[model samples]
Structures are given as structure tokens and as C-alpha cells.
Target chain A: MIFTRSTLMVLLLTVTFGVSFALLSPIFTDAQLEQKTFVTHSGRVIETSGEVLDPVYTVSTVDFDPDEFLRNFEYGRISISDNGQTIRDYTIIAEDDKVQEISPGVFFNVWTFNGTVPGPTIRATEGDLVRIHFINNGSKSHTMHFHGIHPAEMDGVFEIVGGNGGQFTYEFEAGPVGVHPYHCHVMPLEEHIVHGLYGVFIVDPKEGRPPADELVMVLNGFDTDFDTENNFYAANTIPFYYQHHPIQINTDQLIRIYVVNMVEFDPINNFHLHGNLYQYYPTGTDLVPSFYTDMITLSQTERGIMEFQYDYPGKYLFHAHKVEFSEKGWVGLFLVKDNSTSEAYYGN
Target chain B: METSEKTSRIKVVTSGIIPFVFVVLMVAYIFGPGADLLDLGVPLPELTIEKIAFEKSEIHVTVRNTGPLPVQVVMADVNDRIHPAAIEPDKFLNRYETALVRIPFEWNEAEPYTIGLTTDDGTRFERNIDAAAPALQMNFEFVVFFAIIGTYVGIIPVMIGLLWLPFIKKISKSKYHFFLALTVGLLLFLGIDSIEEAFDVSLENLGGSFNDVLLIATTVVLSFLGLYYVSEKLTGRADSLRISKPVVIGLMIAIGIGLHNFGEGLAIGAAVGLGSIAFSTFLIVGFALHNTTEGLAIAAPMSRGKLMIGKLITMGIIAGAPAIFGAWVGGFAFSPFSSVVFLSIGAGAIFQVIVIILKWIREEGDKNLSSAAVAAGFATGMFVMYATSILI
Candidate 1:
């Protein structure tokens, strides 16, 4: 009896509910979401944090000091008496908490690009030319390089940051689509570049793509004066700073990534994309027609672009190739959802 | 009172003769070099006498998320070729998904021609027309209107087969495992092909989900067999004996039925082809109804007097008739692959049913003759459908 009554009521409700849902659901997002970030305040806050999963890759926190980073980048100077700080201070957390120990004192003093590691991820399409305009307010000279796509003139070989700083533009028609890294190509390659010159770049193919999301990580390491063994950083020296953040994307979208490395001694880096394999190869250099892969590795100045659709939604990781790279400095995580995963039983 | 006896005797005479008439029709349908009794009319030549401009790129396009979540409109275009879109059911089409993606356009002058639209599913909708001229803002919407419809239509045939359960109650209570298994195979293949046809999707697309559909489809077949087997075992022996003359007569009926049903999808194809939009809709509904009752033509006689050969022959006619119809219709319908699906499925199911009947005959030690008859039954069923595919 109860079932019968409920059945009729439920039947009526289903139609009403279905019609309401259709009427309410929007088919497309507004254009404003795609626009670049705008500064609301005069001040800046950088994020700092990191983690370590393997010896080859290390994730440490960037102190996220906007002054040090802002000084090296030429966005704009914030006034002391202005509206407020330009950047917001934030924390970068790791999936596996406390991967590595930082030098000096407390285990945490997380570093972030503007307080976030890998700086705010630089996003661009396959054909779009990307410009990395940077300023070096820090005492040392710095450089930048991208991993996903290759640039003709500026491969980040020279010091990208010194005096008033400089800009590097990355241009290419397209490549195998996937997530890739960018970093300073400067020598001693591990030390200076690793200090904080890394990020990700994504290149999405024009057709038959998949659903994907991105997470960015840039490994940072410093030869602190207190380190007893200069060689110890190689075996297990902790990172001084690091950055981590996520890149949300459209549903059924092919996941594309651009990563860079800034550390010196660690000239080589790898990007492991969890879950779905990267569907496209950047640099127009792929061995197979349907080359599907889980991770992409590159050296300083090299960027690999990855494209893949997320058939299933879930939270996954995108991190450095070198195990030690993640141990102290390089790591990031992203969440992918399309409402289907809203229910519990629908996942692996 | 005298008329009643005569009427009963005449009914007997006619019932006995009906099979003969069926046989003659079958021979004519197959050997008669292409002819259809329901040759209603050449759909295009008869109807659609207006000019409407359809090909102007005034083709305005709008992507509506009539679905729950917003969808990024990928690619939209008008294709010339008419290819049947297959939906791999396992394909993860999200909910409250984007449906009815419209490509709006206006023609400077209206004219008559088949208008077609291609969607993500690969299914195309085509219509024939004679139009006034091209006009401004002519709406040529390429709405993927069938995704939801496909999902729902997927339930119909299964519901029909299920509705038949109470009536098809089995005869004996004794265990008939192999017979049951054979029935399971026949239905399993039939539903798979039907669903496969329905979705325009392939089993191969289910990255990992293929196994799941396989298991479910098998279960449905097995469940039906199990219930029937249990029921038959409890009741009594099924009429599995052969009446030779009747067997031949049943074979004839099988052929005739095959002839008539062959054009089942023709109306839909022709309606769509000639741009009879309203009729095209009517045709799909009408044919779907026509197929549901088709199972009974053979099933009814088999129930009245169970002849293994008769059942096999009936299955052939029931299954093969549609192919011939489909083949004929496919010509004007502009979809050639449609017959392949109908043909393959018709063949698979009939082949399965024949196997079941042959096994029973074999166990009884019926001579090689019965085995030969079973083979003939299977072949005739498949051949009639195969032949019908082109008869159109």
C-alpha cells in the first residue's frame, strides 16, 4: 500500500523534477570566467608549502613573499597606503602531508608563487603565443623556461631575471597534447633555477579530445649557508621553497599542461599525469599515431604538452618526474568533476 | 445446424490450407524476382509536392543545454551522406546533458531536397522536400533529439518480450537444462542485436563497460529461459513431434510472413527521404507496433501443435520477413547498413532457435533426416531474410 501511494506521487514528481532540471541547467559558462586575473588591492601575498613523495622529486614551500617575487616580476608596485595588497596570501597543501623537511628551523614555511608554488599557472591554446614578462627585484639573477611547447628564440637559456628583469615569449603551432614543464635553462641548473623558476603549460588539440583537469608544481631547492654538505642536497638536501596549485577545466575537455623547472643541479624533470593517459604529444614529436602515456619527462628549457579527456571524474595528481624533485619541492593536485560524481557509488 | 458442421469442416479445410497459401507467397516473394504485396505506393513519387528552400547557409546555429549541465558545443555541420549514427550505450553521455543543439539558417529561396544533420552520436536525420524557395532565417536545426529518445526506446522491445511471459508459460516441470540454455542463447543474441541497433553504438566502445553489458544481456536471456524451463518442467511434455506435411506447410507460411514484414522500416526511410516529416514520425511508431505482434504468428501455431520443425520454420519467417522489408525500404530510405544489422540479428537468433530444436530431435534418435530438416529450417530462415534484404 505504501509503495503504491508513493509510486503515483513519485511518478508525478519525476516529470516535474525532470522538466525543472532541464529548464535550470545552463548549457555554457559565461565569457567572463575565461578572462585574466585583475588586481583589486595594492598589496601582494604569496603562498608557500611543499611535499616529498620520492627521492628524485621534492616539494618544499615557497615563503610566498610577494616582495621578493613581485620585485622580480614587473606587474605593478603596490603602494603602502593603497587599497590593500595586490596578491592574496594562501597555503599550498600536499596529499601526503610533510614529504620533506625544510632547512634552518620549523619544518614548514611553505613557499608559493606569490605565495603559491609554480606561480599562478600560465594557460594558453596551441596556437596562442605566450609571453612570460618577469622582473628580478631579488638580489640574484633569474630565468624562466616552459615544458609543454618549444620556443624559437627564448628557451630560457640565459638569466631570465636580473637588474630590471626581462620577458620571454613561447611560440609554436601545436604539439602532442599533454601537461609539460617550464624552467630556467641557466647552468648550475639545479641550484638557481630550482630556487623558484618552474611552472606548467598545456596545449589542447583541436579535435577528438577528452575530459581533463590540471595541477601545477615547481620544485625549489637552495644551497643554504648552513648546509654542512654541499653535496648532501644531491642525496637528500631539503628544498628551501616550493609552490602548488590546481587548474580547473571544462567537462570532457582534453587536459593540457605547461610546466617549468628553475632548480640548477636538478636539470632533468618529469611530469606524471595520474588516471587518464596524456593523449597528445607536444613538439610535434610522437612515436605513435595514438600515443597514450601517463607521464612526460623533460630537461631544463624543455616543455611537453599533454592532451587527454577525463572519462571519469576524480581528484588526481600532476607532479615532478624526478622522485627527489617531489621529495622536497615539486608537487600539485587537481579535482575533476561534472556532477555525475556527485553521488558516492559512481567512482573507482 | 448443417451449416455449423460444414463451417467447422470448412474452417478446418481453410486452416489446413492457410499454410499452403503461405508457402506459395513465400516462393513468390523469394523466387518471384522482387515484388511486395504492401506496395502502398512509391512514397516520394506520390507525396511531397511543395518547394521549400533548405540549403541556405542562413543556417543560424545555437547550442542549448536543454540538459542539466552546460556542455561545450564541439562541432556542428550539415553532412551529405546518410549514415546511421550508432550510440555505444556504454558511452558516458552526461545527464541534464546538452540536447537539441540547433543550427539555425535561412535560405534566400526555398527549394526541395533532403536536409540532413550530423551530431556527436553519428546518427543523421534526413528529410526530402519540394519547397517554395530559399528564405531568410530558415531554421535547419540539427538537434540530437534522439539521445533521450534512444535511452527510452531501449526499453520497448524488452518490455514487449516480458509482457509475453505469462502467455508463453512452459509445458513440463521436468528439467530441460540444455533446451533452456539454447533458448537463452537465442534471446541473448536477439536483444543484443536489437539494442546494438537501437543505440547506434557498438559493444567495442565500452572501454571497460563492455563486460557489464554482456553480463546484463546474458542474464536477461537466462532468466527468461530459467523461468520457462521451470514452468515447462512442472506442467507436461511440449508437443515436440513432427507432422511432415504440416512442416512443409509451416515453412511456406514462414516465407510469406518474411515477405510482408520486409518493408517494416521502409515507411520510416521513405518518409524521411521525401521530406515527409510528419509521416516519418508516424512510420517509426507504426513499424514498432508491427514487429511486436510478429512473434505470435509463429508462436501461436507452435503453441496449438508443437512441431519442432514448425517452430524453427516459423522463427525464420518471423525474423527474416523484416530484413526483406528493410532491404526494400533501405533503397529509398537511403540507409544501406540498416539491412545488415537486421539481417545479422535475424540470422543469429534463428540460428540459435534451430540449434535448440535440433538438439531435442537428436536426443530422441530421430534419423539424420530431422537433422537435415533443422539445417534446412535455419538456412531457409536466414536465406529468406538475406534475399529480402535486396528484394527491396
Candidate 2:
């Protein structure tokens, strides 16, 4: 009887300690997400001399990579499907391509998705059905695997691969809205990824995001020497393309950038915008902005949407915070011209 | 007769109606104006430890808010010999979402540290972490390879020897008793060793925190009690068919030793993952020698003439296979919580086996040896195990 009582006492003490510890512990809730306001500006006035002042650009139909047309592609306002079902159908081809001058005079061979490093950004509203038809035109077998909730049978893998010159269809419901990445999950995955068989998949919120001049930027890199290491990195596979041809935006307009880190070899990359603070939406899944910061860090395949309005007209530079990555090729400039003047000049 | 009937009716009505009335009143008090009177409007925040990692030099915790409301994290503090300053991650974990809190403290891997977190909702969470091998430090390929090799290395010789156990049955009964006693001594040493290792997690500061000490103690006591209860419930009933007590005891020892060996495998695997090749090799050698004796221990009780070869082989597998599995797991992720839990349970199980063997010896009435000889044999067993352990 004494032993049983003692055992009960011990058990009681243990239970009390556990419950009290849970209630009184401090480490569980030490951090908080606080809101902070950054500096803001009005609009800007710019005087131009026969220069293009629009962030918009026409898709080059005859380019080596046709998916370059998707850069400024508009994914309009989000809404429920009229038929109460949102079905997004897509087809991608995996093939080898020897491209010329990723950067000036830097020729390289790459395995491409839709003839581009980062296939194409597939966009859809929440609750939409995403159907991807994948074709493997490459000599070696390849498969498409997406990073999101999906059925096992629909997960594009080697066993279910449409082998070389074969076709396979992957279908799933667009979910609990977030930014997701799709890539070749074939063995020798790193080789295929480094060579370029990847893309971004964006699921917009059901309620839709606030209006903005949206743009898609998929950060990627190239292994010039086939050494399993990247020698050059780019925002859109076109190395230094943004620097040579800067993206133009109007001052005082909300600029939303959908950025993705598709760099294979490196573990992390970051976006640091000069002289601007933006509301960061982690994975585009959150209903409200999670963070407001000028610099956003992400690991490989971590993608998100960033929103900010350029109040003054000046060159806003954006690049990987890793100086080496920026120095190689992952840098761009946003030319924010005076909205009133550009509009009048263009007679809009 | 009427008065008695009336008394019985009153008893039944009172017995059922009083509790019903009490429950109704209590419910009304709780849900009605009692809520206003008590001012219990605020819901308590429930914080759960979703994940933890000692990555780089700092501790990273993924905390989840399982409650309906969001929680504000106030401070993250670590308590040890060198108590670190409280770090305010200053983050809010939303309902059904996770927030990663980075605690700025250099972990002393050898010492157990209690991490405490406080929230705005007046709830605190405390977790004990002893050792953490970051994922970056782990080499999965080498871990799996060494784990496989270590498993076979530790028990293959014993397994092969089990194939030749038929000849051993020809030996004398006294020899069997000596071997059994020696095996008990080895296991006793192992149980003690395991307990000591588990005790290390508390940094040997038994007085400072009662909880850690209580955890290890309770695990030992409960594990023994659980096994005893299970065995008794299964076999002690008079209606049940009789099973050989020695066979049951042998299987129990093998299982207990298997758990113990799994812990050793984890250590070896972790060593490999940490890139300490020499240490892993030494551990493999020590564990292999240790396991050979364990094989002997398993076969010690099997003096029953009808022991099948297949059963012996199965026993060998049971005693040995878990080490490889442990090594594989350790290579990928190493958590001190699992280590302590496994070791404590193993110690408990081994301790129970010791009790059983001693009970059998007492019942059999050892005419072959005096008390001094028994003591000497037990001492020799402990000494041999200790000496072999030092090699690792």
C-alpha cells in the first residue's frame, strides 16, 4: 500500500511538472512578427530622348528560347471559375539545346524545359485543376516532379516517365495557395537540374492579390565547364539581359516581382533591391504579407512574391545579395521613369 | 416490509438524482454567469514543439501554434552551467502555422540543456536537449555502409557459433550455470553502463532539476513494471498453456540486449556521420566483442533438449539486426531523447532478466559452487566487459 501510494505520488508529481512546465516555459513564444513602416516617396518626372519607358516588351517569336515570351505575360485578376471548376492545362517538352551567348559570347549546352532553363511559370487561381502534359524529347529519360500536394500516381517520376520522345500527363488540384517549383526528378537529378530542367508554378490566392505591375523572375545558373559547379547565374537564363535591356516601370506604381531561386549547386540566394522596402509574401501562400523587407533570402527552389511601389524615378538595382552571384550574372535594373510625362508622350 | 421497500426506493433515487442535480448545477455555473464571475474569456494558447535542430552554432526551433488563436513569442532562453542570455526572436506563430525561432547560444553537446520559451498568452514551453548532430555533419552514404558492416561485424560470429550449439548441449549442466551467471554479470555491467550514459544527459546535476532525474528514473521503473506486467498477464494465468520459463527469459534477454545494441549502433553511426572514422572503427570492434558475449547470453538458458536450430537463428537475428537499423537512423538524424529512452528501457529489461536468472539460481539450489566463487565469477564478468569497453 505504501509503495502504491508512493508510485501515485510520483506519477502525480510528474504530471504536475509536465503541465506546469508547458504553461510556464518561455522559449516557445519568444519571437513575434511585428509590423513596421518604411519610407515612401511621391512620383518622379523623367525627361526621355527616344528611349522606351515601358516595363512591357514584345515576345520574340524567333528567339532560341521561346519561353522568353512569358516574362511579361499577364496573369489577370483572380476569380472563381464560371463553371465552378478552374482547370489549367499545360504542355512542356524536355530536350537538349546548345544555346549561343547566355551572356555575351558565352555559348553552352543545356537540357531545357520548353526550350528554356526555367520552362515557363504556370499560373492559376486557388482551387484550380493544374494539368501538365510533359514530353521527353531528350535522349535520356526525364520526369516532371512538382513540389506541392499531389496524388502519388500523378507524381511524375521515372517509373511513370514518358521516355525519350514519349508523352505523359500530370494533373492535380491547385491548393492551399502558394508558390511551387517543378523540376525533373530523374536520377542524376543534380546533373539534369544543373543542365536545366526546371520551372516555377504559381498558385494565386482565391481572394486575389492587390493590383500591381507584376513580373516573373526565375533565378537560375549555368555550369559552363560541366564541372558540377555553376560559373554563371541569371534571373531568367538570359545572362545580363536585364542589365543590357532594363525593365521599365512607371513611378508611383506598385511593382510586384515574383522571384524564384532555381539555382542547383548553391544552397541559398537572396534578392536585395536598392533603396526600396517591399512587402514580402513567402511562397505567395499567405493571405497577407508576412514580411516587409528590402532584402529577402531564400534557399534553392524557394520562391515568393515581393510588392513595392517605386515613388521616385531613378534606376533601382536588384541582384543576388551574394556578391559573387551578382558579379557572375544574376543582376538587374528597374528603370522607373516619370509616369505623367511618359504617359503624355505615349498619348495614353 | 413497506418501510424497507420505501428505504430502497429512496436510496436508488438519491443515488442517481443527487449526482444528476450536481452535474446540472455545475454545468450552469460553468457556462452561465459563472463564466462572467470567473472572467475566463481568454483562450489559452497551445504551443507545440514541431521540430528542433542544433544547426551551425545556434539552436533552431520550429514552434507550432495548435490553438485557435495566434501566439506571440517573448523570449528564448537556455539554462545550463553557462546560462545564456535570453534571446527575443520577437515572432508571432499564427494558428495552424509554424514559426522558426533561432536561439543565439553555443550548445555544449555533452551537457543537457533546457530551452525555455515564453509567450504573451502566459504559457511557457520547456524542452530538454542533450546532443544534436546537425544534418550537414552527416554523411548518409558512409553512415548506411558502416551501419551494415557494423551490424554483421557485431553479431555474425555469434550467429555462426549458434549453428554449432548442438555440440554445446553435450556439455555438463554446471558449465551451463557458470555461463549463465557470467552472462548475467555482463548484462548487469551493460545495464549499469546504459544507466550511466542516460544519466549523463542530466549533466550529473541531480539536485538542480528534479524533472530530468524523474524522467530517467520513471523510464527505468515503468519499463520494468511494464514488462513484468505483460509477462504476468500473458503467462501467469492458471488457464493458459504452460510455456518454458527459461525460453521466455532467454527471448526477453535477447530483446533487451537488442535495444541496448541499437543504442551502440546509433553511437557508431553518429561517429561515422561526424567524420570520426577512427572512433567508429573502435566502437565497431568493441560492440562486436560485446555482442559475441550477448549471443552466449541468449543461448545460456536454452538447456531444454528440444531447442530447434531455426529458433536459435531467429534469436541471433533478433539480437543483432537492430544495430544496423540504428546505425542507419543515426547517420541521418541523431536525437538525444531517443538515446536516453532506449537505453533506460534496455536497462530496465536487463535488470528484470537479472532478477529472473537469480530467482532461477536460488530455486535450483547451487550445490556446484560457494558464495565466494559466485562473487568471483560475477566480478570477472563485469571486469571483462569494462576492459573491452575501454578499447572503444
Write down the TM-score of every candidate: 0.27, 0.41
List candidate 2 stretches off by more than 4 Å.
Answer: A1-348, B1-147, B157-168, B201-210, B233-243, B366-373
Expressed as tens digits, the lDDT of each residue in B177-263 for candidate 1 is 222232333333333434444233222111122233453344334433432332333223223433443233234333333433343
RMSD of each: 26.6, 25.4
Clashes of 2: 25
lDDT of 2 by residue, B11-81 (tens): 99999899999999999987897877666576666666544566656676656565667766544445511
Under CAPRI classification, how is model 1 graded? incorrect
Interface RMSD per candidate (angstroms): 23.1, 22.8
**Candidate 2 overall lDDT versus native:** 0.66
Candidate 1 residue-wise lDDT, A1-56, digit = tens? 85775576556546644543453343332212222221111222211121111111
- Scored by lDDT, model 1 comes in at 0.37
